[model samples]
Target chain A: MVSTVTTSLADVASSNAALRAFLHGLPGVDRVGADQRAAMLGTRSIKTTAKAQAIDLAISMVDLTTLEGADTPGKVRAMSTKAMHPGEGAPRVAAVCVYPDLVHVAVETLKGSGVKVASVSTAFPSGRSSLEVKVSDTALAVAAGADEIDMVIDRGAFLSGDYLKVYEEIVAVKAACGDAHLKVILETGELATYDNVRRASWLAMIAGGDFIKTSTGKVQPAATLPVTLIMLEAVRDFRATTGTQIGVKPAGGIRTTKDAIKMLVLVNETVGDDWLSPDWFRLGASTLLNDLLMQRQKLTTGRYAGPDYFTLD
Target chain B: MTRLSVRKTYKLYIGGAFPRSESGRSYVVASSKGEFVANAARASRKDARDAVSAARKAFAGWSGATPYNRGQILYRVAEMLEGRRAQFAEEIGGGKKAAAEQVDAAVDRLVWYAGWSDKIASVHGSANPVAGPYFNLSTPEPSGVVAVVAPSDPFLGLISVIAPVIVTGNTCVVVCSSPMAAITFGEVLATSDLPGGVVNLLTGFQKELVPGLAAHMDVNGLDLTGVDDPELALKAEQDAAENLKRVIRPVAEDWTAEPGLERMTRFLETKTVWHPVGI
Candidate 1:
């Protein structure tokens, strides 16, 4: 995998003041327009061949996530194995997402299987810890063989208009990731408005986020279509301007095959087909994988299967 | 001066909310005298799917509730039904005396099943004498979401079929033949303490909706009590077997009579668990 655009992040914003100015200078989002666009894209009928393909593609794009405080090594291993071999002939998930401490367990289980290990660090779900602890959290996961680092932005800082604190924190976490691809979670639900979501997307991108994510799966209204659409638009617009492509991942509450297909439609229409791959897009979901597997089975077999047939990791 | 009477639009009950069929299709229901009653929401395949989704979502909570709690809820349904006796009697379209009897039987049937809610497990479950040093226990559990093709008798049959399915904590999506009476029944459910989605009532042709419910992978059990035609019942059974769904065959019966626990037990799955007796 190519390194994240970390070096140029410094070039884009030489100082904290410069980063703040750049984020604020970005255009505001029209909430109604974003919602309308999301609803319009959601109505796209993907059936038969396109649906079958989309189901498989969506399955492959999943960052099968389990970020509970009670997650054990055994649970991580089971989830990793599930990620690698969801079902017979079904494509493996893009990665297995877990808390920072369980990265090694996932790494050991997923060894040689090609599924990456993504660890959420930097006091994930709420970036309230000091920069020292957050950096060490990222460094620990990286040293433990995590292939990707999903860090949460300080919503407290972002909401308080301290854009510099949130930007520098993302940059610091990205650097701590070393070569591991950095996915910056905006926690868009806590951002309160679509305009804040739009600004956070640009902030994470300009500060060297290889992927801009919508949530930590910890908040209500997480990873909604309209919120995700704004991030997709940000990546599309950012790619057009800077010749650098940043991926988009919508996490949480996307549990059905139907929901995943709608997100795929959003990506297809918003960023075109370029962002459809696992490298460019991901669905940070846990329950969604089983539904996708069920739909895939329905397409292949001519008969429907039950949840009893699928293993829940 | 003239006074105009207000009539209610009989709509499908899904996920606790009354929604017109997604297809926006409706059918007219006329009385035996050939007078127009009301325009009922003619639900399609999509509505069946939606109702199944709702029933499936409600299954976890309803099935997991304490049996005592379930008994209380079922008894509450009986109480609500009793309070709406006049409305249900009027909707049944017969003379007040016969309709009143049907309504009373329906309410009594609910109370009867409500008493079985906590007792069914004890009656059905057993502790087996195992060959090894283990405690082997078998119990019955609600078999997820059930799809009911309610019998033609709108009042008593509807209550009889639905009461048994829900008494043991299995949520249901019912396709009713009498749309007007079903909608009036829905008002009682809404007013009762029962949770939304516990029992979704749909008014449409069973031929149009049954196929979708039968074929839905999420629905675990099917009650074909209303299907009198052999061919339709056979087709529904075949479609239901796509997921190996547990099916209750349609039987000609009197709904007003004393219902045995068979209807309640038919929708249940037996689960046996073994644990070590000693350290």
Candidate 2:
């Protein structure tokens, strides 16, 4: 396989033709190999002290998301409070993710609490809106004091081999984010192939996204191990040539402590300690926090904790 | 050349699937005459934890099901067991006549419990006579996941303990000594309409398995009816007290005798609600 890690990030996005060539020219993902490696990594025990520490770290790395259409202001406030103080003596989550309209509630609730507020934009889960609308949607969230903007890429454009459109959209949304961090959601379930996931990861990073996320938690086959593995490989390779570190957030379907620990194992094995912190690696999920808290309680108290004690997401 | 006989491996049943112990350990089982019967999976604490997790996962769907629907499923389990009678009879292994009789009794016992599903509510629940302008009523709801320690009678005792717990919608993790018979019963339940995790059967040393379950904060009830050792039962009761678990003490009762409503009622919580009367 030829090395497709471009030395220069600027020239690749210069034109649609150049962006397409750069993406297509990137090496293909060995589908079977990635699946096998992820499965193997998942078998890691991570026992006792290591497990306790990983649970806390995974809890802190959670985005504490609730992106439903029925999300009320009260819901967002409750989620924000839960994110701040997950449980007694437990570390707070990294951020509270909601739709762009509710960013103010999350931001206001999370103020001075050090828990960042992330808002999903660009027509969210579908990304079917116009570029003007997408940019303004992102701007609205940023204006509402969102610390981060999670923007979805147009899969229709990307799958039709219009890599340039996807790349440019990320760039546009990144520009709209201002001082806030921009996380580009590939919605990898719709991406269809590991090869596309790799190319999309590079596209998001090159276009100045602070993090490349997996799914919107609205899609099935979301945030799988093999997909996250491919994205982690992309961010690792991107950081190698450019010396610019990008984050990876595997959202959705990661609802258990075991699944969360497996993600941490993948990060530790693939990218080492540099990306271990919440600023670098994150888990975007709603139901996952309670499981993490439950596991944490088990580690400390030596008895299995039930879902009854924890607040429902 | 004559074909070699394929012997079945007796495994633990958790979440409706036959999985070997997580510890990768198995123990030898002997017949009444002390002859080698089979190798049974010796479950560990992790396995117990997994069973509780599975039981907890199945709780909502099983509990929320309509009483009539649950009745049909329980009846379906009996139908499945009836077809597998000979196999269960052979595994029960006292004598041909005794084994057959026990399996029949088990089937009848199940059918007996199945009949109680829809009717139990009306009989146990009450319309309270309050001295005010309101309608007050009390009904029994399944008290979440319960852990069972099965008695040594194998087939009938296993059926009696499990049938009552599940018929009312409470899910369970059972520690039984008779591996072969329990696993066969597990197969019957799996193919039946009853959901997996509703009855997770673990065959192992009760000493190792009982304490963990008794102390589990997730398990809502503990049935120590099968514990013959007084000391072990006492320790489990103490651990159970940590979580305020509702427990049933052991009794030297005959399995063939008529079972009362107490077995089902013991693991149930009375939900009393008051609704305003019609204007």
Candidate 3:
């Protein structure tokens, strides 16, 4: 009988351990700190072609930031039409990220592009205005023609330990978006830590952010390995908890194939197979396209293409 | 000719104990003279956690203290700051005159917040009119543990953000600017007798410490008044939302231009009570 009891206890212990492990494996459904998330991402191997494919797919779906003050509403509409030409091999750009005022331009520009128009609101690079004005700015951007509103949170609020206010504002902004997607920019460069980055990512997701983007490209220390890792973990955890696959966008400083590949590796390792698709991933960069195109050409012909080979325009 | 020896090391301030950053990583601390002072610790999430725990533990006594009593303590802090005015002026970025003005402003703001502690309910609070003969009143209360990314520059920015939060009874885990003035502020906090954990100071990059506080579940709020980057501010705001914590965004106005009593008042939640009136 004693031996039988010991066997039963051992069985129970094994099952308990298994259960705990399974629970831990579930993606955390909340914002995680940058450092902790980075450590987890770092633990996994960077080798995975599947990860690279996911990143490629994500890049393809991006709304590519291509406005240079020359984007009139008509011009933007024309570009959107071309982007969504839907030829035999034509794929869609995820969304078109544009200046806050130009959101309507992109909206009218890609009215039928099937591509979402994302407007950079909240005073863009400097969120120094009053809350009333910021909220109004987001509302106006949404009303103008944006299918998605990219709103910058008040950094001052985040630094002051007034997180609820920030979260509430995002929620309000998300409500303001109506049917439009809400992509929240963390500007990871100014945030300074993988832990904070993870936290910011989680916060944005919970506050109804459709996508969590890194940096405005205007700040120093744009995007880094550790910061990206934290954001990926946040997405993974958010998906596991809510059964919702939130999107990830690493903006600023991502201008090369190598950088894109690294971020892809981070996402795949942290979030697993489900998130390896365009719907859940995106790249917010201006210069990254040329590098990616160059890499793609090299892969196809096994020869380095000169900068002129691809029309940068 | 005599050779001048240079020192390299940053010490962490915990419960009045000056130790190296627990991470064992030390970064350069430059002074106004362009000289390196000491290498400070690169505080980690663990250190931030410890600091938060310390602040949470200390909140009961600190927040529970009578408003008059709290005011006296703040007054004492002002007094001490006044005495050390010259030292702070020298350490803060602006020239002596500018720094002195900043110090004075900070002292005045501290006193201003101190006075508000006992009387905020009257100034910023109100009674609601109900359909029935019911009395409803709302008064502001502390939001508990706050994680602050202090200004990277110093003096006015730092004091402007930090004082308002604590004056209203919230304990703070502040990540002071990378170098210089932070150490001096730590000295000011050390001598203030404002309770051990009521204001825990961590000297490091705002980028490094903010994430730790943002992700910590125990932290009730975040203040990103010093972070200049719009994207980072948005991210920090987003992260704070994960836990539904209170967040205060950065404003463009000069913090020193006027007393930011509203900033402090904004962080407070008005808890209203209702009772039926009998004839």
Candidate 4:
């Protein structure tokens, strides 16, 4: 019996080492820097129509941001009101992302529209609050009619090699979300490394994040390809681990069709055909729509639609 | 020797006393010999709520203690468990070897987490590079009043789940395994000199008790690591959303599988402070 236990322990240790080696050797694309720029330039001329349609599909699927910092309740209400009906031909953005306290206004305004009201909770931009307050914030958001909650993980904990703490907090936040989808924001800029990003992504999924997001859009150096690549790999691994499909949202600084297609490619390559649909993928951007529309007109008419083809409401 | 059938009744361990299930309902727990032991109490939603209240009330002093002091107290629990190893071994049906290892691992894990009280912040924290020079340092903190579903399995698994939550200064209301192990462990908790509500144990069907705790608006977090069923874990996650409770989905490993420090830190929150650097 003693020998059996010893051998089992040894086997577990060796197998873990092999698995680590295998992960370390896997080819990872960095979608954040020069590599992403090259990829974007390479695909810039792929006949704007197909690309426009894809970008439109991605944008329509996304939940864009409208409120942040200390915007007044009235301004938030107005933003939601305008967001609901942006005139006749305007392609509607998916949803409005806001602070927890303002979730109800957006939810109330967007009622009957399929658009969701997502709230950034658990200390958005910087997750430097107590778990009690964070959980309360999340619960309060859900109660206030937040269709989704975007939570920031304790990057401090993750950096310290405390994967379990990061994982546990994501789980707790997911629980607090109830029916509302929980988007675990990695705040990739703070994560610093692709390896950390990959691990953080898996940790979030296992801990119950419905969607693993790229950034809160508040931080600098947001949304790069390498980071997105690592996250996409994480989503794929999570699917393999639990046989469940999780969503991915890359927010902050995504402003053009070129940017949108690269993310789509990363998702397509990493998770394959199943995740290409809107249900599994979303972009959180306020400016990517018009660029897509401009490119779409160029594709059909074979002439530049110029800068005025799209209007910002 | 004549065979004697000993009727086992599952009971509730509250405030250092083992009492009949307040609900007046008793369920039979079978021993390895296939004979029934004492009937244990099946705790109700009220009981879970009451447990949370007790734990919340106790949090101030428990979390306020110096890490070294908490470490010593946890070490004391280990000593108590070691002294009572024979009782656990016999009750849980594990022989001396399994029981000894379980007790040692639980004790070691407690010590490991106790040492982390003062040190975790330093190890898991840093100062960020902001656009402006500001005095900023991030430190890990405790998420309060956690409601944990103790591993449904006896002995080792139960200890694995409960120790990590408490070591981090978060008080817990634990629904322990349904069988005889909860009672035995409850005895250890009673004598461990742990504060009255610091570690509350409930022995009953986890499915019935978990929803109450998960949906409890006051409970800060839910660790559902013990619910093996994916459906139950999913339901617990959904229920936790009502109050936006922190939900920890079940990991595939056994309680003793990972180093307990990881679990301890997971229940912690990091507080980072930034002050402008314009001197």
* lDDT-superior candidate, 1 or 3: 1
Reference-based lDDT, each prediction = 0.88, 0.93, 0.70, 0.73
Report the lDDT tens digits of candidate 2 across residue range B29-87: 99878999999999999999999999999999999999889999999999999998899
| TM per candidate, chain B | 0.97, 0.98, 0.89, 0.88
Candidate 3 regions exceeding 4 Å error are A1-313, B1-10, B31-34
TM-score of 1: 0.88
Root-mean-square deviation of Cα positions for candidate 3 versus the true structure, in angstroms = 22.1
DockQ each = 0.36, 0.75, 0.01, 0.00
Itemize residue pairs with steric clashes in candidate 2.
Answer: none
Most DockQ-accurate candidate: 2
Worst 10 residues of 3 chain A by lDDT: A1-10
| Model 3 agreement with the true structure over A55-151: per-residue lDDT tens digits | 4564575557754657666656655564564222335667777777777666665776577777888777767777677778888887887877778
| Candidate achieving higher lDDT, 2 or 3 | 2
* Cα deviation of B102, candidate 4, in Å: 97
Q: Against the hidden true structure, what lDDT does model 4 obtain?
A: 0.73
